[model samples]
Target chain A: MSRTAIWYWAARAAFGWLILLAAQVIWLVADTAGVPLSVHVTGLVATAVVAAAHVTVMPQWRYRVHRWEATPAAVFTQSGWFRQEWRIAPVSRIQTVDSERGPLEQLFRLANVTVTTASAAGPIKVGGLDRDTAQRLVAELTANAQATAGDAT
Target chain B: MSGPGGGPLSGPAETGWRRLSPRMLLVHPVQEVVRAAPALLGLLVAGTSSGGKGHLWSAAGVGLTVLFGMLRWFTTTYRISPEQVQVRRGLLNRKVLTVPRDRVRTVDVTSHVLHRVLGLARVEVGTGTSDRRHDSRLKLDALSADEAARLRVELLHRSPAGQFPGTQAPAGQSPTAQSPTAQSPATSPVSPAAETELARMRPGWVRFGPFTMSGLVTVGVIGGFVSRLVSEGNIDLDRVGPVRETWRWFSAMSLALEIATVLLALMVFVGVASTLGYVLAYGNFRLTRHAEGTLHVTRGLLTRRATTIEERRLRGVEIDEPLLLRAVRGARLSAVTTGLRSKEGGQRGGSTLLPPAPRTEAVAVAGLVLSHTPGATGGPSPVTGPDTGPLTSPLTSPLTVPLIPHGPAALRRRFTRAFGVHAPILLALLLLWVLGEPPLWPWLTAAALLPVTALLAADRYRSLGHALTSGYLVTRWGSLVRRRVVLRCDGVIGWTVERSFFQRRAGLATLTATTAAGAQSYQVRDVDLAEALRLAAAGTPGLLDPFLEPAGSASQ
Candidate 1:
């Protein structure tokens, strides 16, 4: 898998870990307030196991991780390990492209790019890219698509 | 020094005091009186009920109304400069707005009955996107018709050359007198030289038929009644009867007199609304053709609103013929534009320019507006332009698929089957009623079946054949009123195919085409799998290809 794909899995792992941590904190507080100690411990253990399983299973699916690609004509992303579906949106039809970075994303020097088309559905976001790289990719894709369209006409 | 050869310093001196037409005070007092009416009535009712200090409260209310009216009248002021128009007003937290000459989109000037008698019109100036906040924009009420016309001309001419401002040039100037290159800032020797001699103006106003006024009033009253019913339960019919009875005994003996009074109140409200619409639609109903080929429409009665149109920004034009207006050969023309701010905040900002005009003028006006802008071709016409390909046939369009099987035999079979299923339910209901065991089953069955039957009938009605001929796609569908929507293929924004589990089993899919404006969504359903794929491919060229291709090719 590519470095970007590894980073995506890492981010997903971190999200799962955060959820587990939150649950553990809640359980510990409940235990201190005279709740059953055994129940609190069981909840913490279950959360930690689920988080570890997510980190392991997500990285093992290399085919799903490797399926996303940006071309001059379209941007395609494929996920799901067994069923493996793909979604492609032509750049010419793209209405708007926006890049956003959250606090965690900023810390990781990453940004998410959402491309909106005139289709009824919500926009598609391709996450886990460095800010500068995402900007350059968007510009290059837009220019390439416009040039191709001009040539076709 | 102030003669023809004078320098900039010798020009007219700036005035610190802003002057507004005195006729504006008429509206100010009326607005104050209307706003205060509710409060005054409430105070009177409360004081009278308590049986003390009623006269004192009434006096205080009148004094407050007068003071507020005066404050409002004094605060409103507007000033026009060579490059910008600024309106500064408000008694406490003042708002100062500056609209640059170039940014002025459309100016609408209107005059109500009162303003017409006083020979004054209200001018509303609309600036693009940024000045969308309704209250913050500039409104000049009761300006002389001539001043409003002049301002409209100045705003139109100020935009870049080669753009259409939707207005005709002055009589003396040739249609193509101003060259686009000559007005370009890069080519021109002097920065502000083009400003002079750009103001040779023309006069014309757009007028709506009498039906438009009635429709506006009816729509307003219906909307008000519906909202009031939803928010504050039903009107007190008991209270209404007593009030009418009391009025009859006190003032009039005849029932005709009571009916007349109620009718008079409704008429007054409608008359005021319609008159307000008329005033805003007053002079310079003129759409000027700007040197830039953008159409600038300025009109208004109280607060003039100006809209600027760049041909490229316009998605499409909708010509509507309501049932009432159809006989008169009159239709309302509205252009859908991007970057429109919604009246309600945060909703989709789909801006439309509505100008009620004759059907005969629609094409001519649209052609004039589109002449100078880029990608201005590809409308619903048989003739093809250089930039736009031939209009596509609706029948063959990828977006148009059969909602049901199309053979005559198939149609007849489907119809009979639908009727057969409904007939049994109706018959069963009739039988139950005769037996007198509370016939509840039939009523319940009908209540459930009515919506489902309607849905089925609608699906059957919308089973239209579509074709793509040239650059246009023509779709024919309907049960009661058959409609043929001729759309330019290039204008189609996006398309999607939706399939339910039952539909998937039946080898049918629904294809929906989304365009820029209006509520009408083009949809065709219940086609074979192969046809669905073909139609989807045509609407969105590469949608199916990614899935069809070998797994690796799409991934990388």
Candidate 2:
């Protein structure tokens, strides 16, 4: 997996743990109001078990994250550890491409790249990259797509 | 004003020949009768129930009927001139509309069965604007067929002269003609051959038979059924039963006089309704091509409409063949043009140049109308083609290879195994349902399994083929209607590749592209990592190409 993919999962795990901790705190508060001590103990045990299960199951295949490579003829990206797969979009079929960044991405100095075609509702976004890298990638890919369109004419 | 011959030319030329359309005599009374039916019935019911105010109510009803008849008679008038056409009339507030020749788009002449018997046809001038915004510009009703034709020619001659009298240019020649090499024809009357050709192109009554009638019948039946259901709770079987009974009885009877009479009346009503629909839809249908590549179309039964489209304004063309039309080898062609708005506020009315025709005819009309070049035809063919392009490239190779410790094939096996693992859940539910003690939980769980299994199967099917070619990226993946959208590399306005939390767990990503037309954006779902980058690069080759010099690159 790419370092970015690992970071993404790590962030998810951290968020999941925060949710568990909140559940534990609510259980403790109920116990202090003299509702039930057994309830608090059961809640704590469940949270720990769930958190441990997630940590074990998620990191098993972390090596399949992919980076995109764009050429004059096509654009492609690959990801998957066990069932390796690839996607290619020829230049002629590409309708448009855009690069965007959200507030969270801005804080992390990262940007997302979105690509669109003629027949679909929403564009695909490839996120978790530095802003400059994302912009450069978008510019190059748009030029290649346009060149192919001109060739069709 | 007095003519050079010393005759007064104003005020309808003081001739009884300048009369209100005969259509007004026939239709205005019918409209009045229809509008008054409910009020008349209500008054009758009230007078019968109360037994008081009986004479007063009867007198009022007679007064209303007489008033309506007179109103219909007085509210219509039309006048024609060599230079202009004017229509003026109103019951309360007067409306006088004058349509100058320059603004008139098309003149349509049409006749109904009644009109055919009377030897009269309605001449409607469509000025390419709604009556609400523009004053009423068309003749109120039918005129003599010969007069309609004469008026059309007169308006055609007046238009160019009206706009630029000093130039003395021919009616067919425009300043913005596309071809510099082609010479314009000198001014002359519309040729006899052109008029004959138009008459030949007129849709005959025979052409409006089974298909049009069946469509009208279907709509009527469905509407009747729905309305009955809404008002009376369940459908009234009586209505359908009577229609069937009447038909059977009419056919079975060989000698019954009353049955013949009833069948004849029913047939007459059906005939009238169908003829009315045809007249309203195709009335005054006229298509004329001006010498300057502009096509004008005018049609309407009551509220006549006209449309004129310049050839240079067209952006794209769409040819549609619905299932029923396709069975009959018929097609409808329409051009998507820039800067033309349907005067109907995007609602129910617009004048189409060509009515639905045979496929070959539709194509010929399209070629004549749009002057389409060779290149615009390539996109539609590829959408239906079998050999789409290559599947992967180097940028996506790393995504296929194991980035973590386990590699990509193992992940697919895991997903496939997970799908297989869910099968027992269905069996467990079925077992509980089969037992004497019914388990509601199991049935609900099994019901949920159906969609999940279907979704997984679809995803697997989609993963089978994803590719790119030299000129375009062709992606084919849709569960309901298989769609293959080709995006030219340079055509890509913008693109995005996304992986959500669920997709991250499943090792899938989606790609989307935005194009110039705004409507033709592409969104490909659950694609492999390699395919997404290839699409992105192919969609934007200039930005993606590392070796290309900045000076040589084109700006998006």
Candidate 3:
């Protein structure tokens, strides 16, 4: 297994902008509801700065830091834009393997693979993979998990 | 099937689907009413405006609750074959849930005061899903006590691995063993040595009740209730204008007296609540080891519960000593076991093997339980005084030793973390000062807390130590509730290494051994990078060898 497609960052950036648009609308409505002009203006400005940082600067940083590896024995995921997390889920512990490509991801030809285990932290999501790669990973992981299902007990 | 309630609890000779006790239809509505009783004050305020209409809605609400209860009773039916359990529920949109026999973990029998009086109990089947969202496998609202116990034992016996299939079982025992339930129809006698009583609640333990955290919890509950009342406008000062003025006038009469009177009242209330909470939860606490490699825990007064955990599901044991309890030489013993936990979403609601007892007695019981338990081998290098009990020799148990204590670096790390938290608040205070007249009280409070924070950090650093027992890895930490866990190294599934930028700068990393047991992960926090790697490698030798070696670097 290898790294996810670079287009994943663009998909995430699209979500960031959508959230900014929602914030702007909420602030505008609040302003109409007799809210102070300064408060609304400050809120809009803060949202805009965050939106800009998220779409442009943060995505590049995220792409640099994010990583994933699917070995025969385990799947390792390095995620998070700021507080990075490195998670390792042994194939023996995997309960289910699923991949999804939503409306936003279809534009970028990317999909996310979720590997769930009965562990406390729940699932490990490997996002931004090319749709075909994600589907292949899911298949490979499912087979590997099935092989080791009863080996531990 | 619509027979009298006093028939054979097998339920009127049902053919395929078995309905719950007809008495169950009343249980849900009663529970709903009790839960909704708190919200009645808000309804009262609404009643003033709506008049009889509000009462009509309340009646409708009761009617709807009863309807739902009746529908639930009518629609819900279950079939338990030897291989699996199947249940179908939902009136309009029907649904079925199938839980395989091997997947069934715990079948707990619980009966509250109401259920006890009505000769009904609740049986919940849990698949060891500690994650709260998808936790309950099946919950039968009401059943006869005898049936509940039989069902629990039978369900547990069928799933021989005990909790779940994929977890470890006892030594040399396969998942499909002799059916204990069917074999022992008469509650057959067993060898005296095979069954040992681990811990039984003494009236003496109740002396430590008022010192526990129950008082604080009760205060919080009462505070929440009062705040809810105020928020709902039911206790608005404006509505009780003269009463409010009278309270003010009374307070003005003598401020210190007023405070003293309120404090005395609160103390009495909290004291009574704490004692009552202790009695209700831990009154008849008993931990006994059964013949068939199972530990049975029976406790509670107003609500009775009997939980049986397979020795195989147990990874190890945890001994927790809260500050107040520690000061009083008391401790609580819980298990670091897999699938023994139910996601009841309570802080204090797990397999608490030993309620707050004398430290020496708790240690003796812990020694006995661990020695009998499969994973835990011998009590770790005596943390308490030797027990001179005539019944059993506690000091003779093999003690775990060579507890590795962190060096000076850990102290520095803790102090840094504590000061890092304090710096921001101080900066905010400084900014507030610059904006206007400084808040003298806030600054003074911060100044007072500074020493306390430092002391707590030092204590936490003191608590940072790790030990490798014979079969389990013993890690001790935490300040408020000092938890020393003995986890079976063999049960560890994987390792998680975490290094934040700060930790990396400090040449430290946190190594967590992920297991299915206990909290699913036991962490060695803020240890040196090399030490963390060494521990991971030592805990599971060749598993972490790739990550520790340089070739793994190339792969990453």
Candidate 4:
């Protein structure tokens, strides 16, 4: 994991807190319009505590557990914030690989790679990778998939 | 009898288009006209609002339906070739579909009351392969009954491929496998296996019905009535004549005794309903092996059903013993055959080869339908004992090996999960106490349930085990309704490895072996990561070898 990747996650947390702050403001306005003042006050306090924890600590916690590796035969993703899951899909099972980038990701020079397999586990998603690394990984997985295309159903 | 299209997969594409039954003109349009009646009424009402032209619009709707039906009947044509079955239809937008031969898994013929009256039947072809984009099941809704039966037999019949290895497969197979040409229904003799009765419903088995969620229906009915009464804000119980009379009669007894009487009455009522329902569904149940290499199950009293499964598609049998049934030493069996996808009203019942019977008989029939001789194989003397030998699925496992448990770490994980589940609820209770009024009874109940949860977790851990035998892999899982499945390793098409955060911390992973047959996928949960990989590698050799390093190193 790179130092730049930490900023990308912190930016996301910052965006989420901004929404929470907006919701608290709406609640305060509603309290002025005959809604109870206690509800607005208590909700604001709860939101403040949760938002502070999210922006300060949760990003580092997620970064610690978020691990992914690509072997010659399979791609393994061990990632989740609270309930971490390690998913394995063999290269022979890869159906399609998709690369996506948001405007925020473009600013950070990062991209996310999603590898689709036929297994019922859905798709293996790996985010917060350098754009060059993401492209190379995609090319490698595609090559591996094609080389063993006929082996799978 | 050769097919009307002559036995060509690609040739005669232009001239060999054969139409369905001519009766479709009367049958299809009547259905369409029935569907159009509601819209015609809407049109009639709309026309009346504008002017007096409602009747004219209604007539036009009927005419449109008739025209569409006639056009569909005229354009639709089907052809059966040697390698593929093709159907083409639609006048302006012509569409063609061709199903390959080897992909065809099951072909079933069903005739409703009307179809039977008209000598017509519906033929369904299932390929056992479904993609999210395309539904592979095909339904030819109208064909001559005889033609439908013939086509079903021909499509479902597969030449028995390789011998089943040991002496067991040799004793079980019909010698006719020597002649592959006999695959055709016309040439194959229908009298070889001679309908041996595999299983028939016993009247006493109906007693097991009440143990299976029947009491819940009674409770639901009573709950509905009570809620309706409360919502209506009723005051006069006497006005409800039946309740008033029952109350008057029970007034002579103590209050507790009166309540008990009512509960007893409800129990008897529910018991009778469940038993009667079971008898109606399974009274005349009969399973037989016919010479066509198919198992036929005919049952039901009011609505008789006859379901057939080709023996070649059968991967194995699964004997399910739910907790209550297990208490009485009873079990149920369902076929793990391909193409018996869980769809339609009666598919589950169709796949069930045996209902809730004594475990001894259930296992005996399982060995019978699976073509195994228990006494001859010496028996499960190693695992079960002499008398109850071949009593469970492991005996039928390709190598007949006992299961290997995932050791104590799995038990620890289960206990942790169980404790984690209870912690939040207990915390909420403490929060209630902080609110200055702790509910004592609910808190005490939750406390009492902790040991039960621990026990359930321990049992579940004990139930989790896997065995990789010669040709099959057997995995035992679940505590309440334990399933010991013997899935053929060669039938396994793929493998999936999953590890949760807690599992990863403990160096454990869940390995799932997916096959084309028998419950689709069987899992070996909470095994050491290295061991999981080795098991996957051993089950399906070189496929997983590339992904796994040699023993001692498995950080991935």
Candidate 5:
């Protein structure tokens, strides 16, 4: 995990909150809907307060919680702040390795690596890694996966 | 009967692409007609309103349907090659689906009333993928009953020479144990190999029907229809003669009597409906071991279903005891195999090894299935010598072995969660009453749920346990549907440990064993964090070792 992940998280949070705030603003401005002014003000206040708190606290908390490590045998990752998850996928069972970078991630030079297995329980995503690190991780995982035998199922 | 390389050898006539049973032509036209009934009716109405053109249009509609049915027969062709089973279809856009012989996991043969009447059956070849997409499976609809049966046998009997030497020895030796006279005519003439009847639906098992609650679905459908009719003002119960008289008589009774009468009627209705459903679905239920290393399940009344599961694809077995069924000591057994229909899929019941029967019987069947798993590498060796004899205690097999409880921390967590959710709701209701909603009685009534919730939480804790057998990871959980899942250790593909803030504070974690079979991921909920790590480490030996942060720091 990179230190710049904090900025990336903050940016992502801000972008999401902005969209929600915009929706709230539009709702408030729509006078034809006939919602009382007090309800609109209360909703806006609540949204702003929650958004501010989330934007400030979530990034630092997530940075502290998020962890990732890849070995020849398996890929291990710990993610999420409130509901943390530790995923371990054995190298033999890994079907595919992928690296993704969103617009915000690209700006912060951060990326996420996802390793999927035959299980529909979903892929293990190690997010908020330095771009190069994510690339290297994907390459290493792909190589190890290719070396293993069997149909992975 | 097998080819040079042990695969099903296709005859000269069978090697080339062949069309489905020509008898399908009869079925397809009728099916198409039924499918287009609504459209045909609309067309008929249009033609009638506009005067005699309706007849011509209706004729054209039926003709079009028949043509489409005929076109289907012309377009579709299948081939049974030594290496693959291929189905090439589609008119404008030709498509070919090839499934390797070795990859065939299950072969399901189904026939509805119409198909049965036509002496036809549908064969669906499952290629052992968890993917639920329709095209993922190779389905040949409306094959002659005999051809379907033979194809099913051929596809699954890849290793024809391989045999289970002592697997079902008891079952094979005991001729009196089986009542082959009861087998359906469709299955009786197919294979002459030694068949071992593992389990059969006893007549007394119908008593466990109501506990299954499948009849509730029927009741819901009826309720929905009635409600729709009432809402649409199509039928007025008060005006209807018999209904009006019944309502009058019902209303004449006292409130207590009315309630009791309604409850009694509902109970009786559910029992009768569920009993009927059970009889229809599992009337001739039989789980038998075919000599060709497959477990064949033949069941159903009106729509006879015969499912063939290659024993090698079977990963484990699940012994499900729903709350109601558990009360009556009834449990259902389902095979935890890959490539079968998912739980959400309509044909999900195809995986059932045994329907709701005695808990002891369910356990015994599970043992029989597990003990005979062919080529189970690194799995626990089968318990030799008459372990299945007179299962006085249901907990004799690894499937029913005692589990390691998640401990006091998990119990506390369960209580905390239960109280945390319920007490707040009670408080909220109190607050609502205080704020002048004027519902003191409702709040008082709801307060009664607090004790029930506490009891449920305790039971949930009691149910939360996991055990690692020599070859399986057994996990038990849930309150309403307590499932004891015994997953083969070799089937486990990955491990995931989850921790919420509350769990972190309590030093607890929920560990999930991810697999491609059954429900995909079975969790050991609210175990000690250190214990969860240890379990994960042991469950898949070298997979978690590289991730562990040294020996002493694993508790962290």
Candidate 6:
């Protein structure tokens, strides 16, 4: 994973917290019910505290946990912070390979590569890659996938 | 012979478009009439209550339905080409759907009461993509029973060049290896070749019905309805004649007698309802192998269904033994096949090879379906053994092979998990009793649950086992719904090893084999990390080697 991934994660977390805070503010202003002012203030304070701690801690934890490797035979990825997952799908069973860059990812010049198979267990994603790395990975996967035979089922 | 349906009984190699059975015209109007009846009745009642203006609406509704129904029949036509099966439909927005003959995974022929009366059936062509949308399928609504039967055989039996010649019938058993003739009798006629019956629903098998507990759902529904009536103030048990009499009689009885009576009624009700449900769903169930590399399942009482499955698409088989069913030593066997719709497709029962029956029977049928060499028996020889050479079809029953237990770490984890979940609740209850002064008997009653949870956890641990055979990776788990899944090694597409925080601390990992078949992925939970990786390597050779790091090179 690229170092910029931390910035992207922090930005996403902060943005989410901002939306939540805005909603809380709107609810506070529109609260026609007889809720105490102290209670509303206390709720806001607690939410802000938790959100700040999360924004500070989560991205680094995720960065440490995430790892990926692509070999000729299979693509292996290790991801997730709390409950980790290790996925390995053979190139022969590779149905599709896609590289995507969301707005936040583009800001950090990072990309995500998704590898899919015919299984309903769903696709494997390797996020927080430099743009060029993502492109190269996608190209390599697509070449290998096309070289193989069978309908990936 | 030219029939009223305007198509030849058995057309040339590449037939042109053909319409549905003409008798379907009668079926359509009746179906449309039934759909419009509620509104028509409401309009008629409104006409009677008002100034009779609504009567015009009622007549117009009926007329429109009849016209629409007739138009539906006129606009629909289907044709079977050498390479593809196509259906063209729609009056205003015409659409044509085509499915390659090679992609056809299953051919289901179904006939409802009306269609049965008219000697018509519906043919559904399953083009084995995981796409569950109805629009993706090619269906001919009402074809002559003979034609439907022929279409199923024609679409499924024709082997495209270079495709697998799936599971040929034992050479001598099926005397005639030729394709079925069009003149063969239409009730999905057995080919001149001997039809091998795999399993049949016996009258004795009905005893397994109550164990299925299917009637429990009905009891819940009825209970809900009764509660709803009472809650909505629609009925008063205190005022109703039979209810008040029954309540008075019940209250007069001793508490133990009352409990026994209630238990007896519930048992009888469930027994009868489950028996009826079993009879309706699986009555005359038959699993047979046709000469043409296909397994045919014919079952159902009122709405008969015949589903044909290509043996090649079959990935494996699952033997499900729910807790109650296990208690009675009953089991259900289902085929794990690709291209077959899963539960989300509303065809969950399409892959069932055997309904609830004796566990021994289920095991035997599973063995038969999976066994490549006839008369083969005993456990499969270890493929990884030295000098074993190339893998051969197992001479052993995969289902009966003893599984490798997950060891004491998994057992300890199970107990920890059970206690972890229940201890807090127990503590909370104690706190409540001490602080809030709750009833002593209630707390004591709740404490009894602790022992049951421990037993469940122990059983769950006992159930966790996995084995890597020559042909299959068999994983067994779950106590409540104990399932032994034998998945073909070749069908495995990917591998996933997941470990939660607790599992990591315990040095345990969950290995999942992802496939395109039934349930998609089956997991062997709480195994040592090294063992998991080794299993993954053995399951799909050379797929995991490059990614594996040297000892102590990567994080443990």
Q: Is candidate 1 or candidate 2 better by TM-score?
A: 1
The Cα RMSD of model 5 versus the native structure comes to: 7.6
lDDT of 1 by residue, B1-556 (tens): 1111122211122442254566556666666776666566667656766777866887798778877877775886666655567777888988888876545555656566666666666677765543345687578765666555555555555434224334432222212332232232222222223221111112321234343555356657678765555334334544678867876574754668778876776666665665455445533344553444344555554444445554444444444455334445555444544323323211211232334455556434543333323442222212233132111222332223232343343244345556678878777787778888665766677757866776666545444455544344445454433333445455555454455555544544555555543332455544444564555455445544655454333222
Q: What DockQ, between 0 and 1, does each candidate earn? A: 0.13, 0.07, 0.20, 0.13, 0.43, 0.44
Which pairs clash in model 4? none
Leading candidate by lDDT: 6
Q: After superposition, how far is residue B357 of candidate 2 from its true place, in Å?
A: 2.0
Model 6 Cα lDDT, one tens digit per residue, B1-556: 2234344333443557778888888988888988776566666656655775777877888899898898889999877655566788998899989887667789899888788888988888887677767686788888888878866766666532112234321122111322222112112233445357989989999999888888887899789767755654334578889998998999999989999999999999998889888888889899987655578998888778898876656778889999999999999998888888555422447888999999999988877676532111111222332112222224434687778899999999999988999888888888888897887767787689888999999999999999887657889999999999988777788999999998888888999999888878889999988888888888777777777773243333
Report the C-alpha lDDT of model 3 over A1-153, residue by residue, as the tens digit.
233354556556767788777877776876656877787788777777777776677656667777778777777777664344666767776767888888777877888898876556546888888878888898899887777523231
**Greater-lDDT candidate between 4 and 5:** 5
lDDT of 1 at B185: 25
Model 3 agreement with the true structure over B257-369: per-residue lDDT tens digits: 88888888788887788777888889898898765567778899989987777776666777788988888888887776767542241253556778877877877777766
lDDT of each residue in A72-109, candidate 1, tens digit only: 65666655443333345666666677888787777767
| Per-residue lDDT of model 4, residues B256-352, tens digit only | 8988998997778777766666676667788887544568776776544557776655656676777777778887777766556532312337577
Kindly list the per-residue Cα lDDT of model 4 for residues A1-153, writing each as its tens digit.
455678898888889888988978876876556777787788888888888887778768878877777887677766775454555666765768999999999999999999875433347789989899999999999997888623232
In model 6 chain A, which range of ten residues has the least summed lDDT?
A: A144-153
Model 2, B1-556: lDDT tens per residue? 1111122212343341255544445655555665575565556556765787755886688667756765755775656553456776777877767775545555555555556555556666765332454355475456655555445554544333334344333333222322332212222134422211121134554243333343456457657666744444333545688867977876776666766786776566555665565566557666655543345566666644445444323333344444445556654445443223332412223435455456566555544443321122112222212111121232222112112212353246435654666767766767778885676776787767776766755543543334454344445443323333334433444455566655557656666654432134456666654555555655454434552232143212
**Candidate number that wins on lDDT, 2 or 5:** 5
**What does the lDDT come to for candidate 3?**
0.68
- Candidate 6, residues A1-153, lDDT tens digits: the string is 898899899999999999999998998999999799998899899999999999989999999888999987789899876687999998878888989999999989999999999888958899999999999999999998888655667
* Interface Cα root-mean-square deviation for all models: 7.5, 9.3, 6.6, 9.4, 3.2, 6.6
Model 5 alpha-carbon drift over 4 Å, by segment: A17-57, B1-17, B29-76, B82-102, B133-137, B161-194, B224-240, B345-347, B375-397, B431-441, B550-556
The whole-model lDDT of each prediction reads 0.51, 0.50, 0.68, 0.66, 0.78, 0.78
All candidates: CA RMSD in angstroms?
A: 10.6, 14.6, 7.6, 9.5, 7.6, 6.8
